[model samples]
Target: MNNSAQKPGLRERKRRETLQRITDTGLKLFLSQGYEETTLDAIAEASGISRRTFFYYFKSKEEILLAWQSGTGAAIAAAIQEQTADKAPIDAVLDAILSLASQFDANELVAIERLLRSTEELRASKHAKYVQQEGAVFEALCAKWPQARRRDSLRLIAMASMGALRLAVDRWVEEGTKRPLAKHLRETFESLKAELGRQS
Candidate 1:
């Protein structure tokens, strides 16, 4: 795998900037005209990049959506690792997820979620990307607990925590309520924790 950081040069920075511009332009267009209606040529033209350059950054229309999640996954994993270094692995994982959830603007996320729900292809792509992200989070936890044998348990806990956050966000979108996303996410996690404690 090519490490973007180690590939130092002016050209690399220019390439990154171009990719960002293309992605930003494509997202804006997708939001304005539904994702299905937006064309790659229009995105390339809007971003002032050639069609070839656009293809260099992303292979297809669906790939742009995947790219956003992939880019954010790395940041989320790092945030979790940094914030949860001193805590129990499960607590750390939940805290990390909550932190990532807080970064989203509710309206923007609701729109994106609506777009994702509207297409089977997008739903599959998003789910696959999330599975990959879950693996990354699992790896980060394993790094922190190399000798721990309960890997499946930890993964299940992480998935459940993430699922709760997802459901909360979905409810917020569905209700069109004015509550902050972080509050809902935290409440969901807390409720899950209480339920688990009761079962035990």
Candidate 2:
């Protein structure tokens, strides 16, 4: 019985490693040759995996680019729950977003942003994914604040916070600035708060 459980666990670990290898190789190729120019076959060849195997891991090249963020929505939701136990709902969500942003390297994020800007298909797919994640975050926020009955308001707040973070990172990357992502993120949050205060 234990062996049966262990078999599945080991298989899953190996599968995750294979998928990561494919994604890392694909990103490198995409960054070098442009996302559209880098084919799935090239990614498979670079990762030493068959094209069929690559398909088993990801349905398309765009899927591979956004795969990390797929399951991450749920993780973000959970992080918000844990981190915001005693904090205000919006503050908790902002903290979670900042924490999540810290998970990736600055170069990796700049590369991903560049790919999204250059690829219309990826932009559409990424937008859809962001909408889905926004829904998840909204649900989590509602759970945290039972009186927060306005879903649209929560979503707008989430979107605004995300937009601020994206702008900060984009500026940082464009200027070749070297700063911790968390610091940029905190500054973005502070700027948003200040802007809101000015309007009020």
Candidate 3:
């Protein structure tokens, strides 16, 4: 409903920065004290923002955990929408995902993986945020495809593409940064394509 849900400097870069601060602080506390042990007041205090200010950026502690993925997921959705209409939907989606991975620091990602595995709540939060992220990407793809092509086929492909990206990240973290993350993402996307083809 609110276009504020859309991102980047259309307005309030300050807001995004504040959200990041809250997210970083919240994540650190979650990792250190355990998610269930951490309180919102502690997070707000750690972020150096008032409790009211914290609520202005996010509704609850869960929203703080979702914040990091939300920002990156928005960017990935925008990238997919930027692709030319000539490309196939799968190519457009996976290429956008790969490009995003190119900008990522593999070491930093591994650190996040460690953080996510730190608590049961964090692990569950990771999966929940991913579902939200996929919904965002799927909506972007829905906007880009031709009306005639925007059927079950497109939705299925979008779901599968998100699944491929998730698997790519899983393998990337598990592999201990032996190779570039972008390469791993691309490879996973290709593997997904082949598997889908086989089922077709």
Candidate 4:
């Protein structure tokens, strides 16, 4: 078997490299200069691509920010799929989210998040990102536990889980703590569970 046949061809590899370069250059400019202030020409120039070439990779500058959010959402979904079947669905989702949080460089996330909230347009995009992420989590859970009866419960858990994560990240960013994001996630989950328990 020619396993080498499965490898990406030169064109595909080059495409991926160019895409990465654009994303990296765009993000750097977005973070260093404010998102609205950074122009497309600046990103294209920094990436060594033509302005028209930038449109081939992304429809708009906002798409670049969403691209970063999309990657995080996919990572959460991937982590959810990796959870063992025996664990409670909520716990599995929590662990997956915690794992994702643990991987982030706290300072980098703080900067990115601040940028996301810097303008009205970006704030709307940030909210949309959360909605998309919640959908991703729900879809991943439904895949993991295929029982029809569990659909509604899984949806609820996904919503609650994302809520916990949002609260955790907000507090973590507000405090600008050296403490790890995972710790904030754990505490947020604990508080959520405790509050729910009180209601029950």
After superposition of all CA atoms, the RMSD between model 4 and the true structure is: 2.5
Q: Write the per-residue lDDT of candidate 2 for residues 81-146, one digit (tens) a residue.
A: 777467755678778877777787778777777787676787787778777777778777767765
How many residue pairs of model 2 clash at the backbone?
Answer: 0
**TM-scores of the candidates in the order shown:** 0.85, 0.74, 0.79, 0.88
Segments in model 4 whose C-alpha atoms lie over 4 Å from true places = 1-17
Candidate 3 differs from the real structure by a C-alpha RMSD in angstroms, to one decimal, of 4.2
Better of 2 and 3 by TM-score: 3
Q: Report the lDDT of model 4 for residue 152.
A: 99
Mark the regions of model 1 whose C-alpha exceeds 4 Å error after superposition: 1-7
Q: What are the Cα lDDT values of the candidates? A: 0.77, 0.77, 0.82, 0.89
Ranking by TM-score: 4, 1, 3, 2
Best by TM-score: 4
Judge candidate 3 against the unseen true structure and give its global Cα lDDT, from 0 to 1.
Answer: 0.82
Please estimate how well model 1 matches the true structure, expressed as its whole-model Cα lDDT: 0.77
Model 2 misplacement above 4 A: 1-17, 71-75, 143-153, 178-180, 195-200
Q: Compose the digit string of candidate 4's lDDT tens values, residues 18-67.
A: 98788888988988887889999999999999999999999999888888
The candidate, 1 or 3, that scores higher on lDDT is 3
Q: How many clashing pairs in candidate 1? A: 0
Clashes found in each candidate (C-alpha, N, C closer than 3 A): 0, 0, 0, 0
